[model samples]
Target: MAAVAILLLVWQGVSVAGLVPRYMLPAPVEVLQAFWKDRGALWNNSLITLQEAGLGLVCGVSLGFLFALVMDASPLLYRAFYPILVITQTIPTVAIAPLLVLWFGYEMTPKVILIVLVTFFPVTVGLLDGFRSVDRDAVGLLRSMGASKKQIFWYLKAPSALPQFFSGLRIAAAYSVVGAVISEWLGGFGGLGVYMTRVKSAFAFEKMFAVIFLISAVSLLLMALVNGLERLAMPYRKVKQEEREDSQ
Candidate 1:
């Protein structure tokens, strides 16, 4: 917060002192005023983007989870598919967006697809790593105790994967909004990106800044929600932290 305050103060000083033109880099207060003025429009557009992001995120996570399960279940399948996954990510999203728009016709489907493509890799990789990282000795012990594969998975693998899954989820949460905005830029009836395009065309730089800040806020909010979910999903983390504090 202090760092952000300092950066804002410097930005204000530069803008107010005419070191940078206001049109090129508006003062923070001017951006705030723009945001306030367009609050209603911004809210409406934001909801549209949020809906796209949320749907993409849910679908992307589910898809990645299923892929992770399949790959973890079969080493041959992992070998066959892992390279394909990495190859898909190698294609730049911007390059793909226009094609998606062309095929899907400027609707929400392309945007959702773009976001899923952007967000799923981290989740798939994180979960694969976690599932592979489980202790061999522990697995052997569980097997010695006559544990079923399902029992070993639930008791060991699933719990082990939660940390990495949430780590990937945090990244995915941020990426989801960004993906939605980028896809919106290609073509969309409504969204922060569409609003930005309009304001930019009209030379409303302050409003542009306002929308930029709003996109960032939305991304942060998504990440915070993911963090909250992580806490709920792993209450044992809190218990461990409390025990460490008590020992200290």
Candidate 2:
């Protein structure tokens, strides 16, 4: 918090010093004022982006989880699909966004698809790595005890994968929101992206800064929510950390 305050102070000082033109770099105060003045419009647009992000996260995380499960179940599937997953990510999203817009039209589908593309890779990779890292000895023990594959997965692999899954989710949360906004940049009816475009076109730099800051705050909030979920999903982890702190 102190570091952020210092940074803001430096920004305000620089603007006041006229190091850059006011139009090019508005002061924090100007941005804040614009934020307050345009709060209604911003809120409405923000909800749309948030909805797009939420739905995208759901779809992306679901698909990624399913993909990881299939890959884990069969080494052949892993080998076949793993490369395709990696290759898909190599394509720049900016390039893909326009293509998706063209195919899906200027609706929410393309934006959702864009977010899913940005989000799924991390989750797939994380879950795959986690599943693979499971102890073969433990797996063998379960097999020797006449445990079915489903039982082994439920008791062993799924729990092991959760931490990594949550890690991926955190990354995906931020990416999901940003991806929606970027898709809106190409073409959309209303969203933070559309709002940003309008402000930029009208030379409303203060509002531009306002929207940028709002987007960042929203992203941070989403990440924080993920962290809370991680804590919930792994209560033992939190307890262990607390024990360590007490001992220290």
Candidate 3:
């Protein structure tokens, strides 16, 4: 918090000192004022973006998890799909967004697709890595105990993979909103990205600054949400009292 305060103080000092033109980089106060004034539109647009992101994230994570299962179950599947998945990311997101909008029209479909595209890779890779990282000895022990493949997966693999899954979720959470907004940038009726495009065209620097800050805040909030979900999902991952004492 102090660091943020100090940075803001330095920013205000720079603006007050006229080190840069206000039009180019508005003062934080100006941005704040603009944010407050535009709160209604921002709130409405934010809702649309948030919805797109939320839906996309669910779809992305689900698909990625399933893909991980398939790949982890078969080495041939992994060899074939892994390279293709990595290759998909080589195509720039900006390039893909326009095509998705063109194909899907200006509705929410394209925005959600963009989000899925942005989010899925991390999750798929993370879960796959997690599944593969399981100790071979543990699997052997489970097999010796006459555990079925399904039983082993349910009791061992999934649980062991959860930490990495959550880590991927954190990354996906950050990407989801940004992806939705960027999709909106190319074509959308309303969203933060649309608002930003209009503000930039009109040379509303203060408002642009305000929206940028809002976007960052939204991304951070999403990440915090993912972190909370991680705790809930991995409740057995308790911190030992001895570790706590050591830290203290």
Candidate 4:
């Protein structure tokens, strides 16, 4: 709330001072009005983008987790694939967007694929690090007790990795929305990206700002959802009442 208030104050100040042309950078009031006027269209486009982002996030994270597990189970596979994964990140999404459009055309497939590409790397790396960074002492103790590898991984490594995995998930959730929008910008039938393009072409600065605000809101909401899931999945990580009292 404080941050938002500060931004609004600055925006209003700039508008009143006439620092930029009204058409170039519309006042917050104008943007709010534009948002209200186009509420239904904005909502429809936003829903399309959200659906693509959600699907991509689910697919990316699931595949990433499975890949991480495979890598954890096999040193050779890790050595063979880790560098390729790193190289994939070097190729900018903007460059890939056009090519994806060419390959998949202007449809949800390309956007979803782009989202998956953008989201998967962080998740894979985070999970792999979390799994590899598991307490060796704990592993040794489990081994001494003749615990199977599956048992050790299930009880120790997987649990230990949850916090880190969710950290990556939060990042991926934010990126997924951006990735979908970017892909849609390159080529798409319906989405905020396409709406943004239309608004820009028509020189509707207020509507552009409105769409941007909506996109930011969507990203923040997804991040918050991921944080909630993290808390739910790792309840044991929460500070116990006794621990809180002792710390105090």
Counted clashes in each candidate structure = 0, 0, 0, 0
Candidate 4, 243: how far from true, in Å?
4.0
The lowest-lDDT stretch of 10 consecutive residues in candidate 4 is 234-243
Q: Single out the weakest 10-residue window by summed lDDT for candidate 3.
A: 234-243
Query: What is the model-wide C-alpha lDDT for candidate 4?
Result: 0.92
Spell out the clash pairs found in candidate 3.
Answer: none
Candidate 1 on 89-187: residue-level lDDT in tens?
Answer: 999988999999999988899999999997888999999999999999999999999999999999999999999999999999999999999999889
Q: Please, what is the whole-model Cα lDDT of each candidate in the order they appear?
A: 0.95, 0.95, 0.92, 0.92
| Candidate 3 lDDT tens digits, 116-192 | 88899899988988998888899999999999999999988998999899899999999999998899999999999
Candidate 4 lDDT over 49-89, as tens digits, reads 99999999999998889889999999999999999988888
Q: What CA RMSD would candidate 4 show?
A: 1.6
Task: Give the Å error, residue 180, model 2.
Answer: 0.3
- Tens-digit lDDT track of model 2 for 31-85: 9999999999999999999999999999999999999999988999999999999
Candidate 4: residue 144 Cα off by (Å): 2.3
